[model samples]
Target: MKKIRFYHTLKAKIVIIIAMVIIFALQLMGANFITQTERQLVNNFQENQKLQMNFLENSFAPFLEMHENPKDTSEDIDPEEEINALISDFSGTGITSLIVVDSSFVVIGNSDTTQQVEVGQLLNDEDVRTTILQGSASSKQIINSQLNARRWRMVEPVYSSEDSQAVIGAIVMESNIESIYEQITDITLIFLRASLIAILLSSILANMVSKAITDPIKEMQTKAKAIAEGDYSGEVTIYGNDEIGLLAQNINELSEEVETGQRRIEAERQRLDSVLSNMSEGVIATNRRGELDVANNMASQMLNLSRDELAGQNILSLLEIEEDYSLRDLVDRKEDITLNIEAEEEDALLRASFSVIQADSGYISGIVCVLRDVTEEEKVEEERKEFVSNVSHELRTPLTSMRSYIEALIDGAWKDPELAPRFLDVAQSETDRMIRMIQDLLHLSRIDAGKSELQKELIDLTALFTQVLTRFDMLLDSEEYRFKNYKIERNIINEAIFVDVDSDKIVQVLDNVMNNAIKYSPEGGKITCTMTLENNQVLITVKDEGIGIPAEDLAHIFDRFYRVDRARSRAMGGTGLGLAISREVIEQHDGEIWAESINRDGTTFYIALPYIPYEEEEWGWD
Candidate 1:
């Protein structure tokens, strides 16, 4: 720390200050007294010099007033000797020197005989020159610092006796102040003695005041140190209720307030922790610098990291966002923005939003992020869009065809009976296809909406299988049929295999499968229909000895509007919704329908129905 000198301490400082202030005061008082004394002495000296100069100027008045004629002889005007004699009279009166100068600053007379003298010489002194130029009496003291002697100069202007306004010359004189210096020396010794006595007296008072001030201050410091160390117990004794006393009271109150605030803050922290831990949405907070500050369990889970792992980590690194994008950019937005991020080790998509935590100054102090798992939501939205698009496409083809056919009939195709009948028939067929597609769409929609009710009833699987076979035989044996003599074989493992099912919907499902088999079967090929019991459920298979479905199309055979051979199925008067409808119907009965394909040999479709005893199954179609 700080290196404090002894003088900087309170006692030393107080003593020094008192000493300085007292010394300055005494010195000023003494200086003023000495200055007044010296001024009076100088005034007296100048007055005496003025009296002398007046006497000499009066003596030379006649010589100056009687302007000599240019033709006057030496006997008539010999005033130079009288001027020199007048200057000699003041030689022993402590007068250092006296010179009479004309208006030109040229010395005309000198008083001191022992010194060098010239009747006509320039003084080479500004004081004398100023006196001569300004024609005014001026006095100054020339103090010799080493010798402790002061020399005084008095410059007096002499006017002509005849015309007082006309200046004749000036007199410059010097005097010594050795006697005054001796008196001043004696006064200085007395003043020094008084100053020392005063200083000794002040030292005691300074010590007392310094201790009075510093004692309370040191106590306050000790109590403050305790408070700084988290100790709130202290007694601050008031000292005269001064500013320092008031400061002590404030410090005590501050300590009490700090202790109370710490407890309140702890309670608030616990409440916040409880709220954050149980929230469903992942909550994360970051400081203004975009480094992580607080995170909840859900936030850690969403980031696929532990709470410890996220500590001090930059939030930007959690998301593989676009180039030059950062968490600060998102947090600085006017409103919350959705940021797509990978969560769960980059396996799931999380839609994270950043909300700004602003201070009272309206500056962003931190960022609070809310994250939602939207992977499934995004998939569903895409599926909905695709469904709408597919439905529109499917409806448009038939609509376009119907429009064309109807226009053809209206635009004179009806005038020719053959073309008119052909166009009308095609239009009717297109309308029928549209109706079937709409019905299938409605059925599937009802199932998806969980509104489709199954009238499940008890039925014999063998009887149901035989009934389905009979319907197919009748369809093939009709008069307008194209296939000739299609061989069909039935293999029933048990005479009566009971199953709980929606009998009518199961009939529809089996019919669709058998029809599909017949459509792809080779001409006169054998179709083997078998029924067996496996795992307490009836398993039925429809194997077609025709061109089997390709391996690639097997999985998608049950998909809506999917066909192995699209062109061929369309030609066979198929709406391409049969297998899709069949799958839905089978599932409604708590059964499953799937296709097994062999590249070119044949394909078998299996149906598994849950077996329910006649006593337990619901007999009514309810």
Candidate 2:
């Protein structure tokens, strides 16, 4: 931890705040006490000055009357002498000066002996003149800055006894009332010294008390720092069971709880990692900023990158969807996206589903994406659609032909005897063609459903191939293919190649191949059928000297309803399902079938079945 500045520390702040409050309170109390005491003292001094000025006013009125009317003088005393005696009596009573002014502003007498020469002169004081004019008494406390002393000047107006309304003279008296201020000043100085001593003691006490509170807090702070650094090893020092001490105890308990919770969280994280690594589908998670947060093992493998490469990478760029979707678009998207990932060898199609991660406050925190491989599924769906279309087309062609012929016979063609029989025979042939196509479709459906069971028996491939060629030999002689002029050539082994197989299914496979050979062969072209044992299996091959299948179409030859040339195959009355069904039957017997062809040359299809060698005695042969 760094060193804290004194003013910035809690202890310093507490002491400073307490000192300010104490100073404010003491100043308020001292100021109020001084103001109240000064006001009361001034009031009492003013009352005493008024009483003395009233007595002087009575004593001077008789002398002032004699000066105004000398012809009716009752007593033979001098007016100035009596006024002087009255002024001199108050001189020792804290009076600084006393002056008596008769009517017309003439000074009658003076109490200060040094100012006795101004007895008959007019008084030069403006306050004395203003007091006589206004016929009112006034007092003013004046400070003589030159003399460095304070005094109170009081003025009184005297009226004659003979006529109460008549102004006789005015008395002005100055009293040294500086003692009032001296007393206040002395008390103020004492209070200031006491306040300083008190403030000094208070600061010391504040520092000590603040330390008691802050010491525990500092210890708790150190403990908190240790906890933050993953070292929850110690407890905060407790001073007492006060709020601060209770806080220390809570911090200790919290450290223990955090340690336990951290362990549980670590265990949960490990389990999640294991599950994610073993998952078949790829999983990716991103933060609110769309940066990658978690990329599981499968996700890394699927993307052909490592976890390190994915970390902190934007999710849009990582998934290669930056061009299509922004982060906000993915967050708001309602449907799954199909992504075609380009690779060096081949492209893969992955279906990505998105789920938003939301907090309890309804904030969208991130997104989780699950990727599933959907390549094979999409391919199968396309094939199924093509299969349905082909089946419909094949069935519709024969049905339409039969409907036309039958309608023609019913529309009086039967009455023409010649056209009627031909129409009926054509309809019957179309019906048979439709029936045959339907049967092939049902057989294929059974094979796809895994319901085609093979009835296995030991059979000789040599005899089976010879017998098949013999059937074709008789077929060429029949009227249907007699004009075709085809020949069947047999290249078979003399020794018997014995194998366990379903004889009926094998015969059907053979018939399908031989029919294709005869149908596609050129006129007088020879159909070479060969049978041999190779690689622990029996291989049967049929080669046709017809228009060779295109190299691109060879791979799909065994696919249902697939034709190299649909028009020619349809014109020849071929269902396009014979080779497909043949392939299925051969595959069910644990055999393989494929074709090799070149354009403008010839196509050869080979069927390889598992073969077994047996002794003649086992077969009951001579």
Candidate 3:
């Protein structure tokens, strides 16, 4: 890995550079200011010294001129005394280093007693002395050996009024310049020190100001780093109403918004998880890359794999499907598709359906594979189809036979009168069989379609049963039939047993069941018809002591043209439509019809009708 560089941040570097520049500028300014201040001090000192020298020269000039007359000088004044008086006068005027030189360029008088100077000896360095001898006023530069410093020397000539241009003694003055330079140095030092202190204080204050600005920025950086790494819990605290504080507040708001967004995303994720976990249909969802993203519990079980084992696996690999069975292709198709995935074992069959999950824009985003165990449902459907085909073939066989036989007799067998009558009877019976089959088909169709309508009315149960029994009275009275075991009971006798029903249909249902009972009964075996009302329903049961239906066939006995004993039923003149049609008519009145039987014990067909019609308001006598 490459090592990261540690570069100074923009704010820090900028602040540091600005402070340095300011300090540099202050130092330069201080240097210039000290130079100007020294110059001013020197100028002021020179001007003050020159003013003192001029005042001394003016004060002595008048006194020296008044005593210059030849006749007046000899009466009262000596030269030495006069010279001393002139030096005293110069000292009294505060002129330091006052000296008097004659016009011959020689020192004439001096203020210091230890140094008595000659009046007229020629001065070797004669710049100032020559100026005074030529009657000119002048200033000179001289070194004071005692103080080891420079001095300003001025010279002036004293002349008589009659000879203004004549040579005369001169006055010279010298003043010290070292004290002025010293004061200038001291003041310059003071200014330099003050400038340095100001620069130092300013640097410290600038650093503090920079820190105040950049510290919050640093905090913001820290918070931003945390957010980038998926931690949204940190906040930037702001302290004042400046730009930095406002920036911190904005950062804080942004963090809150991010946290809220994350929470909402989490909630949505949980909701999706719940939906997937609880879904009944096995859901195996794949991404656009054809990788399995999620698989619900049902999907895991359907694939016979653990949850963890299915995750992140290729969808095709997880399903153990061929490579050509691409989920990506299915999604690209954008239509629902059915795929049958056979089990690994030869005899086992497992089918999986792949559907494309589409977005609102109608693009397929992923694939959802729904798995189901459809073995039983597929088997039942196959059986139902086979049963229907068999029924059709069976019914067609009998109809074809009857039609062929009837046509054969009509074409030729009628030529013989005896054969014709017998053939006609057979044809009639076959026709009746055909009629019964058609009627049974119609009845079953009506019931299945829920279109069977019954003519409902209040019915007296006792009279209906009496009429049914009376219709079979001759069979009951015959000794050969042996009605010894016959019994009829009406438990709701005097109560009228009034029920809302289609009486004619109910009687027909009862008669059909009773006839079946009588036909199936053994000679002298019991035949029972019982009527009772219980729980607001009227129940009629007809039972026979005969060979009963097999347990397995009892459930399907009422199916159209279904016979438990086909040959025996035909021999007994049964069209196999009686029970089916009866069941339809009974059920049309909002009733139930069923049969109970055991092998060789007996068969009982029970019919139950509700006392109140399903449509009570439309029912008569309601």
Candidate 4:
């Protein structure tokens, strides 16, 4: 027995399946052909035997007539001799044996009786005896010991003419059937040989067909193995227009894409490596596994460890912190975390900022560590804070002294009626100055603390602008300030320009802006207030053709207590917090406020307020 390998290749399996199906089909056809041919041969043999039997029955009539008439009595005519002559004639006609049996089942004449036992000694079988007794013909095939062969035997009863009712004897004929079996066996052998040939051809054809299919797959496997070993230069050749050809095309395209992607990735990796090494700040990277996969030169130096020592080590352990503070924790938490890691060999204070590196799917893939030495930055910040505090304190000292002196004069100098009004006016002016300073401080504080709030609601912006312009209506009417150049369009409006806003705060902002415009403008200078709707928000602009703000002062106009000219601002009673407060109010409404100025062209302050109030809850903040 051949040892069958359990692991059959795809080609082998397919070939085996096809061959088995072909062999089975051929076997079925061969069996049907053999069976049909055998049946047909048997039928033909039976038909020939019937014909022979009919001839024998017809010839027996003449012999029976001769026996009845007792012919040739004077010419030495022997009846037994005549019967033997008839048997010999019948034997020449392809019958294997011919015998005449009497009414008592005794054989009288036979062609080959001498070589075997004579008629008197031979026992008559049931078929022959029954035929004579019934006076009818019957046929069967039996094995005869006298001839030592199988033979088809037929027996017919013969009657006498003198007594028609008397049955005389039976004429029996036997034909050998061995030749029919020989012909059938020869046909079967031919079918068996044809079937074997068909099976062999089918097996060879199946092998060829299987090879056609499996060869492409084998080539694909070879290419895939080569790709695994980093050889992306090969191309797959496609054959014929079928699924296999399409698969080959796809494989070729995939190889090209993979090669391109690999090159790009290599370039990116090299660029990142150079950036990390050259950066002044220390950079560290870790994979999702929480191990330090990459560290820059600065990072290695800051940690007082070689790159080899840091690589593949758990970042938390390498840093030697007690708590489980690591890059992994920062990435998993998705929140900014600060860790103070100290160098083992050096006295360096390293502040590390751990940020999550997220993929496009919003999954935290890794963490990026940006380590900076903040020792100098911290010192600078502290010094700036102290300097601001000192400046504020120094400015407050003079204001406080002025307030005290003005109060004393108002209380005592009123007794001198001649000097009372001047003292009272100076006291009020000093008080106003102090009030402006305090208000500026409060506005700055509100912006710094992020506590500014806007109570927004829909209001007729046309009406609001009209009211703002009315406050300066008296100044516009005076000849001391010519208003011909001024263009204040109250009629031109969005019928109901509405904005969600704090009405009181907006009014204060408008008042301060309009007052500054009026005070700075020359007698004939123009002041225009224009309103427009843009991007679902209302843009209200105040334009003034006056001594415009200096370009250098434009950026700092919104700063607390900041002024282009301190003496001029004091003379005009200008509180520098107006624009600062305006900015905060606009921002609270999810809007924006800014100023555009040139040295001499003029200045325009723009305030944009959203039509709808933004809900803070939607921002994912508590």
426 Cα displacement, candidate 1 (Å)? 1.3
Candidate 2 ranges with C-alpha deviation above 4 Å: 72-76, 112-117, 261-622
For model 3, the stretches where C-alpha displacement exceeds 4 angstroms are: 1-391, 403-412, 474-494, 612-622
476 Cα displacement, candidate 1 (Å) = 0.9
| Model 1 whole-model lDDT (C-alpha atoms) | 0.77
lDDT of 1 by residue, 190-273 (tens): 888998999889988998988888888777877877877778886777787788889878877888998898789689767877
Cα misplacement distance, residue 304 of candidate 3 (Å): 28
TM-score of every candidate: 0.43, 0.44, 0.38, 0.38
Across 1-622, the per-residue lDDT of candidate 4 in tens digits comes to 2344634788788878877887788788878887888778777877887887667656665555555466524356555677777777878766887887767676667777554648565544777877877877887778878657778778777777567768777787788776787887898888778878877888788889988998897788778777777898878778867999899889888888888888997887788888788889888887777678779999888877888998888767766653766454565554433444555543455676677667899887667777887655655676589648744753564477566757767679667777777766766676776676676666666666667665666676768877778767765677755546544544346576655567877887788777777677666676788887778777888888877888888899886567777767767776566666767766676788788887668788888877653455844689
The lDDT, on a scale of 0 to 1, for candidate 2 is 0.86
Model 4 segments beyond 4 Å from truth?
1-420, 475-491, 612-622
lDDT of each: 0.77, 0.86, 0.70, 0.73
Point out the higher-scoring one by lDDT: 1 or 4.
1
Global fold similarity of model 3 (TM-score): 0.38
Ranking by TM-score: 2, 1, 4, 3
lDDT of 2 by residue, 206-239 (tens): 9999998898888988898888889989788877
Report the lDDT tens digits of candidate 3 across residue range 1-622.
Answer: 2332433665556556766787678778867877787678767766776676566555555445533444555556565457667687767543666776555555656776554454444545565656665667777566777768867677666664467676556677666666666777787678778767876776677678777777788789889878777788867989888888999999889988888897896887677778999988788887776778778888776666777988888877666554666665665554444344455642223466677768899887677777766666665676589658745755665567667767878789778878878777776776777677667667666776668777777777778777778777666777856446554433334556667777777777877888888778776676777777778887777787888888889889987567888778876667677887887787677789998986648988888878753454654555
Q: Pick the winner on lDDT between candidates 2 and 3.
A: 2
Error of 3 at 530 (Å): 1.0
By lDDT, is 3 or 4 better? 4
| lDDT, residue 422, model 1 | 85
> Highest lDDT among the candidates is held by which one?
2
User: How does model 3 fare in lDDT?
Assistant: 0.70
